[model samples]
Target: MRELREYLAACERDPACRAVLLTSSAGPFCQGLDYTCLLGLSPDKRRRAAEELARELKEFVRAVAGFGKPLVAGVTGACVGLGVALLPLCDLVYVSEKATLQLPYSRLGTVPEGGATHSLTTLLGHMKAGALMMTGRAITGSEALSANLATGLLWSATAYEDLIAQARQVLDNAAQIQALESTKALIRHSLRAKLEMALHSECRLLVHQWCAPEFQQRVRDLYDGGQLLLQKPGFDTQ
Candidate 1:
C-alpha cells in the first residue's frame, strides 16, 4: 500500500506516468493481511498497526477511486480478501481466465473493509453482493466478467501478461488515454465522496470487530490448530 501510495503521488507529478497499471508477481494479486504477523502482535502494537492500516487504506481507496489518470488492473491467480475489495475501485480491470476472486471475511467472522460492501454492491447489485459477502465464496474470472465485476476476462493463453500489454497499449495512445481519463471521471464523479465515506466506515467496523466474540473465536481456532502463534522470536503475545 505504501508503494501504491507512492505510485499514485508520482503519477500526478510525472507526465511520463500518464497511466498506471497494477499487477502481481505474487501468487495472488493480494492475499490481504498476513495473519501470522497480525496474530503475533501485542495488544498495543496491534492497535497501532490497525490505526496505521486504517489510515493507509482510507487514503489508498480514495486515491484509486478519484485518480485523475487511467488505472488498470491485471488480476491473476486467486485474488483473495483485499484483492477482491480493490477491483471495483480501478478504472479498468481484466482478470485472467484462471483467476478467482476470494472473499473470506464472513468465514473468518469479520466484517468487510476497503469499502468492498458498497463497491461490490454498486457494481454487482444487491443480491449478488449480499450472497458473496455473507457466504464468503470465490468468484471466477469468467463469472466476474458476466456479473460485471471484471471489465473482461483475459482469454489468451498468457492472460495476465496480455492484460498488462493491453493496458500499456491504451496508455501509449494519446487520444485513447485522454478519452479514457474523461470516461473514468464521468463514471466516478458521483462515487468519489460516497466511496470515501464507505471506506472509513468499513475500516471502523473492521477494527471494532477485533474484540467481537465471534471474531476472537475464529482467531482462537487458528491459534489452537497450530496454524498461527504469537510467541515466535520478535513477537510476544504476553
Candidate 2:
C-alpha cells in the first residue's frame, strides 16, 4: 500500500498521466495484511506492527482523497476491511456484479482501520454507518450502488476495460476535467476539519482495540488456521 502511494504520487506529477486507475489482481481486490506475516511475530510484536500498518493505511486513504487528478477503482471478488473505506475516496468506483463489500473489524474485535467508520459516517450517515460497523455485514455490488457507495457495477472480466474507457472520456474533455478537479479541491478543503477530527478519533480507537483480548485471540486464531485463515469473515481468500 505504501508503494502504491509513491507510484501514484509520481504519476500525479507526470505530464503524461492524466488520471489514475487502480485494479486488483485476478482474485480479490486486496485482503490487506498477510496473516502469515502477522502470525510469525510474537503477540507484542504483532500489535506494534499492526499499529504502524494502520497509520500508513490511513495516510494512504487521505492521499487518495486528496489526489489532484481523477481516481478510479475497479473492484472484483471481495472488497473487505480497508477496501470498503478506500472506495469512497476514489472519484469513481466500479465493482463487479459478484463483488462483496464487508467491514468485519468489530467482529475481529478491533475498530475499523483505513478510516472506514469515519468515511462511512460522512458518506452514508450515522445510522447506516453504525449498522455496517456494528454488524460487520457484507453488501453486494448492487447493494453498494443503491446505497451510493459505488458508482456502478460491471461484469468482473470487463470492468478494467470499461473503467479505463470512462476515465479516458473524462480526460478527453480538458475544460471539464479541470473544472471537476477544482470542485473536488474546494470540497475537500471544506471537509478538511471534519476529516482531521475523525482521523484523530480513529487513531485513538485503534490503539484501544489493539490492546483488547478478543482482538489478540482473533489474531492467534488466524495464525493457527494457516493460510486457510484468510478465508475468515471480512476477507476474500478466493
Judging by lDDT against the true structure, name the best candidate: 1
lDDT of 2 by residue, 8-117 (tens): 78977887766788776566776654434444566688688767766876677777777887787878777777778777777788888888888877667767776666
| lDDT of each residue in 1-238, candidate 1, tens digit only | 6667666878867776677777765455676654443455667777676677677778877777777888788777667777788889887888888888877787777778888878888999999988888898788889889988888778647875677678777776656666877888898887777777788788887776764455666877866885433332111000
Stretches > 4 Å off in candidate 2: 34-47, 174-176, 222-238
| Winner by TM-score | 2
Regions of model 1 farther than 4 Å from truth: 35-37, 172-176, 213-217, 220-238
Shift in Å, residue 80, candidate 1: 1.0
- Candidate 2: minimum summed lDDT over ten consecutive residues — where? 229-238
